[model samples]
Target: MSRGFTLLELLITILVIGALMVWAVPSYSSVSEKIKMERLAKELSGFVLMAKSEAVMRRERLWIHIVMSGATNSSGDWSLELTDRDTQGVGNRLLHLSGKPFDGITLSNTYTSDQISFDETHGRPKSGRISFHPINASTDLLEMRTYHRSAIVRVCSPNSALYLNYERC
Candidate 1:
């Protein structure tokens, strides 16, 4: 004579739902972290491309400089800064790009130089490669040597490539 679920049936349903949530919570957190890292990597790659393009379009020297926050010689957050070659052809201009904290994403150590430029003649990176490692949720360090996944942008002349996985960077 019951139109709806009995007490036992309702309790069983709640238990099953609770079990699923418990199982899914960890997986969902992991997926979200991966997505945030991936997105931040893509954005960094785009920034490099934009600088290269701008250099050629403006017929001038445009460069990108990476600065690491330091406290008593201890490195912290890494910030990307833009610099333009001055009238004397020196990279003395500084401009900070503004953006929100991109989903707690952080950059890892992959780039070798603190500053890099694009050749105005070829619209290519002057030299060297830049890398972005997604900080592990487990480890807060910017260096991902201990982490497995990352993203890279390589400036290898005509062979230059972007959107590369960190392992290959």
Candidate 2:
């Protein structure tokens, strides 16, 4: 008799592998989406901190413009551009991060007023004294939904306080 596996054993092995994949694929995808969302949030926070520091050091009006555009199918690109405008009335002395979107993520809410422009001297934009969310009196939500995946980043501004709420959608 052959020492190798019989036909029956081979079929069973294939079926077991298929079953394992059916259970693992969805979980893996979910985890991946979560990781992407977290990474984007961290990047945004870092950029904000960097802009603030630069403004303070240079003593100039450094602006961090957060722009989001595109749809879920188009792989939307949102970027943070840092520009320094001095008292001389010059516009955009420096261009930082020219609108780069996160990997595996498409941006939505283009008209959702998600732009958060902040200057070192003025702190945040005209919306309120705080940057992020929960500062503006409007009920407008700055929500960033991940691509084909199931994840969302809801930004709310209340009482000049910015809050980011991350949840699986």
Cα RMSDs, all models:
8.1, 9.8
Among the numbered candidates, top lDDT falls to: 1
* Tens-digit per-residue lDDT, 1-169, candidate 2: 6589989999999999999999999888766655554555566555655655666566665654545443332243556567664322247645554333444454343322333344445343323211221122133223432221221223333333443354322
Q: Looking at model 2, which ten-residue stretch has the lowest summed lDDT?
A: 128-137
Task: Give every collision pair in model 1.
Answer: 150-166
Candidate 1 lDDT over residue span 39-68, tens digit each = 555556667767767777888777777665
- Which runs of model 1 end up more than 4 angstroms from their true locations? 67-79, 85-101, 109-113, 126-129, 137-169
Per-model TM against the reference: 0.58, 0.57
- Clashes per model (N, Cα, C within 3 A): 1, 9
Cα displacement (Å) at residue 97, model 1: 5.7
